[model samples]
Target: MFPTPIARTSSGTQIAYKIALPVALVLWLLPLIAVALTSVRSAGDITAGNYWGWPTSFNLLANYTAIFENTPIGKYILNSFKVTIPTVIGSVALSCMTGFALAVYKFRANLIVFFMFVAGNFVPFQILMVPVRDLTLNMGIYNTTAGLALFHIAFQTGFCTLFMRNFIKAMPFELIEAARVEGVSEIKIFWYVVLPLMKPAIAALSVLIFTFIWNDYFWATVLTQGADTQPITAGLYSLNGQWVAAWHLVSAGSIVAALPPVLMFFLMQRHFIAGLTLGAVK
Candidate 1:
């Protein structure tokens, strides 16, 4: 059974919930608040060990500007876009077709094959790093945008398929049957009917995958090298001088790098909520 909502709970419980909410929220946001504070603090503030304290000076514009002027952050951001966009498109596209087949078609191996895709999600990706790296090296795409994007696409397809298959399976079979009676081909049925209906799911999944790939520092570092090929996640690590950590610049870059996914979630918030809340999917 689901837990009772605060509105339906006893007055004492409701009061506790109200009191706890802001406390928890502040606790959650403490680190982000620190980062934002750090991003604007002058370099002297950082050098003098002023972290988690009042800034001696604010270099909001200067800190932000220095990242663009002094580092390859712009290129790293561009590289993140290149990898993330293609991975989102590729994984979502593949999942739609595979989802339709696994959801609608009746076959002996359907569940088994579907389970195979689902099973991939459970495997620890860390274990596969060595082999996956070797795979890219052997394929001659190591340290390239294409290789990183391709790897993300493949790894993500498993989860995307699981998300989409359950969504498609919940769609009314009568719709597909209606299309067949109207002499519509399967491809058209999928393209015009199912795909049109899948917009919410696509939007939600795109946002999720975009956020995942964009924040993927682990894979970004493991699969690629240097600023030219690395995403903003890894590129943030490169913001330091040889002898210095330059935490302020890294914090500034962190703020810059976080903007896209935050904007993405806000833009797709409507569709993303709808996709998750649909009765069938729920």
Candidate 2:
């Protein structure tokens, strides 16, 4: 059985929960608060070693403006979009088809294939970095947005497939059977019946993949070298001077780079919630 609801908990426990809530919230938000403060601090403050202290001057607008005016962050953001959007579409589309097949089809190798997908997710990505980088170089796409996107699509497909397979499996098989009984073609069944039902999952997965790819720094640094192909995560380093670290500007740029995903989640909040909770209640 599930644990008792907080509302029904003992008075002492309720008091403890009430006291712990704000403390936990502050702890979670402390890093973000520090970054926000740092973003508005003037460069002099950083040089004076005034980090985590009151800023001598607030340069909110100047710092934000300087990132675009002085750095290639704008181009990096565009590159991220170019890479992330395609990867999301490709991974989600492929996962849908693969998930549908694995969930619906009966074959001796079906479980084996699904297990393989699951197993791939367990492998440490760091271990494959060398080979993956070499492969990209061999394919003549090294240091390009296309190369990064291709790798992302391949790596993300397994998790997406796993997500989609379970979601599809949870769907009623009777619907598929009914479509077949009506003499509907298999392709038509997937297109007309299953695809519509998959909208929620698709929306949720898109948001997840978009965030993952957009915020990816490790691969961004490992695969691409400069602003020409770097995503915002890696490109932020361009703000650093040879002798100075512009922490304020870097913080501002981070806030800027984080906006798209935050907006994406908020805009799709309803759909994302529905997708996640679709099978939870019943």
**Candidate models: Cα lDDT each:** 0.89, 0.89
lDDT of 1 by residue, 207-265 (tens): 88888899998999899999889999888776654316577887888899999999988
Query: Over 4 Å off in model 2, which ranges?
Result: 1-20, 238-243, 269-282
lDDT of 2 by residue, 42-145 (tens): 99999888989888889999999988888888998999999999999999999999999999889999999999988997788899899999999999999999
- Model 2's alpha-carbon lDDT is 0.89
User: What's the true lDDT of residue 12 in model 1?
Assistant: 96
Runs off by more than 4 Å, candidate 1: 1-23, 240-245, 273-282
Pick the TM-score winner.
1
User: What's model 1's overall lDDT?
Assistant: 0.89
